[model samples]
Target chain A: MSHTTLQKKKLIARVSRLKGQMEAVERALEAERPCGEILQLLASVRGALTGLTGEVLDDHLREHVLNAEDDAARAEAVEEISEVLRTYIR
Target chain B: MSHTTLQKKKLIARVSRLKGQMEAVERALEAERPCGEILQLLASVRGALTGLTGEVLDDHLREHVLNAEDDAARAEAVEEISEVLRTYIR
Candidate 1:
């Protein structure tokens, strides 16, 4: 299997957990929970997201950047990751 | 009503939408969609999250920092927000 396909199960699991966290935030807001609690939840979600992003990025670097078949392909891979990172960090 | 309470409905709406976006990512990953598509979805989710965080922070600034009753309270509010921001930006 391709590297990405191999990682699919784990990645999906992380996304499912993230969905649950988002749902909890929604429920907390609907129930008029305190701002402090809500902010705490948001912080946790943000952390989880960062973690997921890092994992995906690591995989991308391995499959695309590091394993590129040629210099041209490596450059393209670098640009793609750079573009995504630009959008992501903003 | 307090500022946070006043914004609860809108905030919840945003959270619900975020939940939906996250669900899409989960589905995409499960179906083994292309990595590019998954990254795009992830980026959009991240953007939505940043927007939500900004809205909550705005309300926090208005209700807690700007309208704080005294110097001590203001200091505490500043510290609280700073702590959250530090964790968030990490």
Candidate 2:
């Protein structure tokens, strides 16, 4: 449902990269790294996660919300999603 | 940079939930739960992660890409994002 069989490898690769980022975060924590450095690493991981999530959400919009026939509606969907992100990401 | 100070608490809450979901996945793995159940739990975790990622991505788009001054450019951003998602989410 999320992706076709052919897409699975690339998708898994992305998740694997995310896992690597998470592991980096864990390593930083384990090493008792400085607060600033740890925070920076955490931010990096967060950004990576955000990127991954955005990819999936965009797919969901195309698959579940967007319409090729309606340009105005498509813009509205973007706006709606943007508004929700403003709330949720915060 | 990612979120204003006022948004930090809620943003942290969302990350906390993600942590909880991840812990559940770990527990399931530790318990050697049935393969099917474990896969389901993984799927649930994946979905949660996707949801989290989507939120932050939306914020980034608004902060880094979208424009109130230009509707056409805004829609183009959406379409471009959609295309990338189609490739990435696969």
Candidate 3:
């Protein structure tokens, strides 16, 4: 099985929680919650997303980069990860 | 109106898109898509979430900090924002 498939259940759970968090933020906005409270909620969601990203990135490195079959394949995987990271952090 | 309320529709639209992007990521994982493709989807979600965070943070600065009623209130708002940012980037 692929690295992501190995951890699929756990990853999906995290994504579910993130969806809930975003919904909460939406409701808070609908109710006109204070900026401070909303900011706190947003920060929590941001932190959670970052955690999920790190997990998936780790899996990608293991499955695609580290375990790649050849030097050229490894280099290609590295480039793919770099592109994703660039978009992520840009 | 509060800063967030002023932009509530726009903000909620962004959050809805983020939720869709996340759902796409979840679906990709469920289908056991290749790690590289999954990583790209995840990165897009991360980037979208980051953009949403920036919009809300900017609003918070204007509403809670810049327009604070007094020096002490402004200081408190600054601290609150600082705490959120620490968690966000940690």
Candidate that scores best on TM-score: 3
Tell me the native contact fraction for each prediction: 0.57, 0.00, 0.71
Question: Just chain B of model 3: what TM-score?
Answer: 0.86
* Interface RMSD, per-candidate values to 1 decimal: 1.5, 10.6, 1.3
The DockQ ranking, best first, is 3, 1, 2
Which residue segments of model 2 deviate by more than 4 Å? A1-90, B1-6, B67-90
Could you tell me every candidate's TM-score relative to the true structure? Answer: 0.86, 0.41, 0.89
Worst 10 residues of 3 chain B by lDDT: B81-90
Best by DockQ: 3
lDDT tens per residue, model 2, A1-90: 322122445544655665566566455445544323434444555556556556555654664355433676566556645654554454
Winner on TM-score (2 vs 3) = 3
Model 2 C-alpha lDDT per residue in residues B41-65, reported as the tens digit of each score:
4445556655655654465467435
TM-score winner between 1 and 2, please give it: 1
Question: How does each model score on lDDT?
Answer: 0.80, 0.50, 0.83
Q: Candidate 1 on B1-90: residue-level lDDT in tens?
A: 445578878888888899899888888877777666677788888889988887787787878789877888778778768878899665
| Residue pairs clashing, model 3 | none
Summarize candidate 3's per-residue lDDT along A15-80 as a digit string, tens digits: 889999999999998898877788888888878887888878887788778898789978988998
Provide DockQ values for all models, in the order shown. 0.63, 0.04, 0.73
Worst 10 residues of 2 chain A by lDDT: A1-10
Candidate whose lDDT is highest? 3
Model 1 Cα lDDT, one tens digit per residue, A1-90: 435567888888889899899888888877877676787799889889978987787787888788877898778768768878998665
